[model samples]
Target: MRNLFPQRVLILFITVNTIFSLSGCVSHSKDNNDLLCVEKNVLNTANAEGSDALVLKNFEARPANGLLKEISVDLPAYESVVYFSTDHRDKILDAANRIFPWAAKDLQTIISKGFKPDPKAAEPSRNGLYVLFKLPNNEFLLLQGIASPDAMSHFTINDNGSLKIKLVTFGTETVSGDIPLVAYAKSDNLYDVFENAWKNAINTEALAGRTAMRHEKEYPEMFTYLGWCSWEQYRRKITSDLMVDAMQKIEESPLPVRWVLVDDGHQHQTGFKMGDSRMLSFDAHPETFPNGFKPLMDLRSEKIKWMGIWHAMNGQWQGLHPDHELRELDPHLIKIDKKFRGEPLPVMMPKGDSISSWMFYKGLIGSTKKHGFDFVKIDNQNRQMRFYKGKENPVKTVSQHAQSLERAAHELSGGLINCFCSDLLSLMNTKYSAVSRVSVDYLLNNMEKAKSHLFQSYQNTLWMGQAVWPDHDMFHSSDKFAGRMMAVSKAMSGAPIYLSDAPDHFLEELVTPLCYSDGKLLRPLAPAVPLPESAMISALTTPEAYRVVAPLPNGAAAFVAYNLAHPTPQQIVKTQISTQDYQHAGSFIQPAVPKWKVPEEGLVYYDWYDGKGGLLNDQYKIELDGFSDCFVQLSPVKKGWSVVGCIDKYLAAAAIDAIEYNQSELKLTMIEPGTLVVYNKKPVKCAMASKVEELGGGLWKIYFPKGKEKVDVTVTL
Candidate 1:
């Protein structure tokens, strides 16, 4: 790699209380006004040969005025793509952000002269938690904020073509001493760059007490089975009678719904508006749920495995009500110096101390478990920073609250779904929770909204998948506009698959492709992520289909392409898929030898939606209409044979629980019964298959009896 650093460097110090700028090389200065100095020692470095090496230049700043507000860094502007948050909403929960490409020539102009806001603007700029730069030379750099005990950090583009790191603290709380404003890493791989930077950022002495949960931790059991949620079905108007009727319909329907989520409306709260309401008590609302969940809990059986309830992370949107019963447990009323709807706003929060916070969440979750709930979905977690902004230390307050909530939820219930918690501080404090909502609520009818939802869910998974199991939110299977698209997206997500359809409103055909009749989903080995070739391509601006892939069991891969053009593209968009897109599909598969060993015959390609089959040596072209999708499977051909898996399911290969290849026979174990398709150059015999048909060109169709689970069939070639 060409060295970008100089042998001898001269650092200039600037003394400014609010903002400081650095440009070009300058001689070393020793003036009294120069209170800020740059440390010459390199903290961390990654050395790789050729263009793959990502160098970290030595540059550490010591604040001039006891507290540092902002620092700017200048670097060579190249052709790059920037991924940043567009608003204040949590990146994962709200799904409101944009990724754009910048030409090498236009980078300087765009950075120096920021765009002017227009009332009719399609995309707006806002402060971002982290900014990722995809350099043209196959290298990536990620600059992210590290949450400290007293302050949080964000990034902005300065007018002088520099990247600025700004720190936010609780009211009057200063970030003094040697504080690392921003943590960064450079790598050829996107995942490596992000993980390295995030690890370096959070593993500091300042954030020593807080621990982040690993992505490989065991997620909630409900994620493996099909589920139903009450949010989109009944919204805030859900009642006990409605829930009972819904459950009765679910039990009778062919769609196997195992877990039930009792969403927001069941809680007792006080206020005129839903968004401004504060929770009143832990008990269910008397008017809505007269018996307080006993009738609902009675419906649980072998078929209905688990039940979960929803609550805000801070009790409710506006926090606890003035006369809430839990107030006696030592609640802290934080008065905001700001106004909401032209009125003074005050929020009641749990005490920041570990003991008090633990008691606060314990009271809420303990009562929930007592009422027969199996888990809790904590929403509005990102609002903790806003509620306690001026009251307590940002990191300490968020860590304590998150720990208390997760601890209580795990101990009392079995699991917790971290919801509306996409902020850095909240994400860092996620010590035990394994499941998190990765996108906004799935809406109905609107095709644009559906496309946006899919785009957000898939794109957010690029980073959010590193923290927790992504929950794409619930959808309605009965919607005529976007039902199939949503269903296919969920199947490809490798996350939990749930629906919010009203009673007797589901389409069995769409649901069957995702899970078995027993409610067990055929999930991929890992979460689906964007193909490396399509990583920087934005569907909003470009007329291209967004491609995502996930690893399936037994060395197979599932790839799905979505046409997410907004306002709907007029003409069909043609996209090409090749073996390159499916390379990472088997990265998560165990017994890794099956995936790494390339067969002499190459891989077999099967189209799930179109029902086509062939060798995957050449590129496959797909034409997608507006808001449509294309699903395909690629499995390696071994010993002149290939198992196409169960062709009935969307992610067909995931249905194979186990596969063993011997000298002349292949033993296959399946999770569900379906049409098993295999490719063999020689004749094959299978006794378990009721009938076998030879479709020309070495493709054979074997039929397995319906209603059989764990079907084992040996095919002798």
Candidate 2:
């Protein structure tokens, strides 16, 4: 609470009132005025007064004092706990957020009803990956666990206020040396603590060289173009003829769709059921395809630049069928070993060796390449743990599977879109993949679910965005419910912009603002992250707007505020935007260089949707209605002038191809013909512009006519 921790030492605290009573005494030191000791099993804080200590009970470290050292402390009382946990243990996929209030006086009631730890599990329970405790004085403590193939970590809060931490090896694999199990950090800023703990966990010796950081990875080429998917339009009923018709319609529409994703429904399966069926072969179903992927791929469309297909990470949701031809490639009938309707479930999977796994995936993806597909959307990738549970070491199995799939896809196709694969193991295994679906499938025509989808997508990006580009999934641009809000968010998300509109349902009005006429999207330079102050607050439970910020090219930043309050609160939710929000925007640029150098003169701020301008040194307040959003842009001023880029697009600054300014002149290069907005203290002359409209407050709008793709203009300052 008093910021007592040293600058470099990360602090994490835990308090426990064990059901199995253990004797512990509290002692104080007169010279230091701090709690010196708390008994045999208790670990005391060095620079704290009162009952501030951490308790460690039943401590056990693997390999007899390995990398993980023993921890013992009697933790002080906390105000509440914020954790991320999943209900499924055997096949841990996704985790959701939960918060529990704590009080020292209500220990009995809190232990009985507030928190309940699950029974001990043979395999590491999917209990939780991250935990945050709010101290009584408003400071925060964070704990982050590592999830890898060789080792897995998780924690649980006991009913008696005890915290149980588990770190174990997978299957029968043994560790000869040290491995990172957990990381800790403390900060008054929740965002700082969460990010620091994650960095520490991933930077450990076991994980450091295996994966690439988000900034180091390159987003797939399809991300720069506007795209469309067939999932929401045709689900599992998609056919060759249906897909051809959809492509024809897309080409005929005014909306410029550059890429097409044939999601799901096109796979060859043996059973009538969807999702539960097993793949019989890599060939397309004869009934639906009639020939193969040729008919759909041969569609004449110059606007469609790239096309891809979807399939599960495994051969299918239930893996390959027993009689599949590829079964000879070291196939194993994995007995799920879990009772389903009083019977053990069986799943077939390829052998987890490097050679066999690589060959299996190469065959499946090669078939797609032969048919002229450019990329793939691999789904359900988080089920690796269940398929190879006892057959091999989890670390090797998961790492091999990921490497095989990524290698095959990268070698044969453009890239892969990873879906349903945000689990800790899967996230850490993304060595070559670039894009990942961060949230569940997009809901249609449901307002409540739509709000939840948006909220989850932004919140999950706090961690998921660190490993790969976060795909918010696809949304229907024609829907009247939340189409505008989704479009605005996508423009700021720095992710691929794709739609799932059915035939003849494309809404040009809503889609036009997201990209140029050539289909290039107006995206931010980096993915949007939750505003630091709003990181700890749950948007769904609180009557407040969830805010996220992204840094744009040219030193501009965009902030989107979403009103996710349910039941439509009567009072308006307001948020403030200032220079503090974009102070770190320069760090997002590549090569460790700042694109838009901030001058001592400060910046010029403006609203994207509304034509409002002001000095960024003063905070700007935004008020929003229920389920709506407000997009604000901040541009730094240089030499008493600022280029606001294209005002027609949602991410206005993204439309500028290049900009250079000096004491007497400013040169601008535009990506497309639009109204270029700039702020200057004096009048300026532009020769290439068709006309110039001058607004008050040093604001000017320069109109460029539609002609060449790249328009260059010189303004005499």
Candidate 3:
């Protein structure tokens, strides 16, 4: 494609999935014919095209005489349709890359009068329909969009000046909906410009309780649960027997799980067939669940709050399910030219009735509900935006399909949806699923990737978290190097906790306490906040630290820090640790000894690792290794006396789990048949049912039978 303004050719380039690591050059070109370039890295690189690829011209632009009900346009993957008139083109460019709600910056604040990079440079001129900012390394940042009161354009801009935008409309368009234009900015690093845009957005949209309102409405439970998914372990090979066995094992463990996830295997289409679309028919795989999903449904208990299954957005790889019941309802729903899995599947038409789309979704989601599934992890959801063309109806954009499916999931299944691979713009404000995967899939044990993942999770928390709880995907239970690192990151993410390890690989000692234990969810005091860049050492030197400062439901405030650093990258290889080794790995790493100035008033900082801490000093330091963490749960210091440490014999529970206290009483919950220790400052009176021993001036030993629910301890000042 050739650019309409300068007539430059557009070329498409594909880079890594999440990170951009390419060898390219930034040439300073004065000639308009020359294209300056920098390496572009993006998560969805497959669909991205470079400036050399194609030039898009004005498609159409018209004003609706009346309020349009809704406008839905379907385009190819990564392709977007924008409607614009000659006058509105500049207005759209000024609003490029503004993420809704959180980051909306006005053009007046963004631009200055007669702004030019260099005094000697050519006077700023708009020869074409829009202006482009020349960037560093001879690149340009293009900012352009479609703007009508109801017709808003959503955009995703890359650090390399590559931008993707989709025009959203509430009503039919009277103008041509195809004004493809690129806006520009001059910069050394386009990524930095994007960050500035986000900051500017925050300044404009920082309304008190806005985030809180979202949390309460979209994620009331703040869903923290011990979940098991079938992806990492079983893949498409999961069976009824295997899940049943896993459920039995989960029940037997001291850890409590509220949801059991049936990841990616139960669907019926593309069976055992490589080179076929990974999409599956919504029906359960006959061989895997011969008797239907009733067997799995029967396994739910009070602790097992929901059983979730995975399915694609439009059935299989953006095609309709051949076996879907709605196929007979409307022949117009199916695109005759598309044989997704050897059959023409239905597509959500733009001009179709809401009832038709609702009924279509009802059939798919209803099928799972019939089999006793309560939650649905909607995968390949990005396909909902893929351009759709029906045989008899107008083209439907993914935006319309997304809204239709969301409503259907809400109406049919009570809005219990976990959106994966879906656009953030669609989910936000619509109050989509409580849980959403924000970052790309992380490595099982690669600490480097884990670091990047942690940074991205925190980034998502800061920017997109208000939309939904950001999920960091799954972490294995046996990855000694980075498993716990990822787990801590997940907990800090305020998202759900799910393990993909097999039944035998369940590392109770390490994994159970992260999400839940004894029916109590162990969430961070607040969402994990990334430390400022100044406070952080490079990933090459030390693990990055994220601070979670929140007062527990109990009286104590939590000052916890998680380390997401590891030694190597290849550690993410598929490997499993033996049950015996997992139970004993804690023996090798000594408890962290931390020193730091406490944050709260009248409170003393006590390290929870091995339970040894004291009064806050000027500096706080800890002996931490890679993938390890230290928490300083702030306790009130009455008469200079405080409980500094606690430990569980089996390592099944966290140090915080060793002591549960209110104003006057402390209850120690036991997870294993072993001894417990409470390192405290003052004397403590124990109940008759417990055995207490004085180890030293401040350490107290409290012994309780294995699996005991609670043991009381009274403190004497």
lDDT of 1 by residue, 92-125 (tens): 2232223222212322343433441211123334
Model 1, position 638, has a per-residue lDDT of 78
Residues 480-541, candidate 3: write the lDDT tens digits.
66665566566555567777876677777766546324444455433443332211222322
Clashing pairs in 1: none
Which of 1 and 3 is the better model by TM-score? 1
Q: lDDT: which candidate is best?
A: 2
Residue 138, model 3, lDDT = 43
Q: Distance from true position, residue 658, model 2, in Å? A: 3.4
**Residue 612 lDDT, candidate 1, scale 0-100:** 74
Worst 10-residue lDDT window, candidate 3? 584-593
Q: Which wins on lDDT, candidate 1 or candidate 3?
A: 1
Give candidate 1 misplaced runs (Cα > 4 Å): 1-68, 88-122, 159-161, 176-180, 205-209, 212-215, 331-340, 586-598, 694-697
Runs with alpha carbons beyond 4 Å of true place in candidate 2: 1-81, 87-126, 133-141, 160-162, 169-176, 187-196, 272-275, 330-345, 390-392, 584-598, 662-665, 681-685
Error of 3 at 675 (Å): 8.9
Against the hidden true structure, what lDDT does model 2 obtain? Answer: 0.67
Clash count list over all predictions: 0, 10, 39
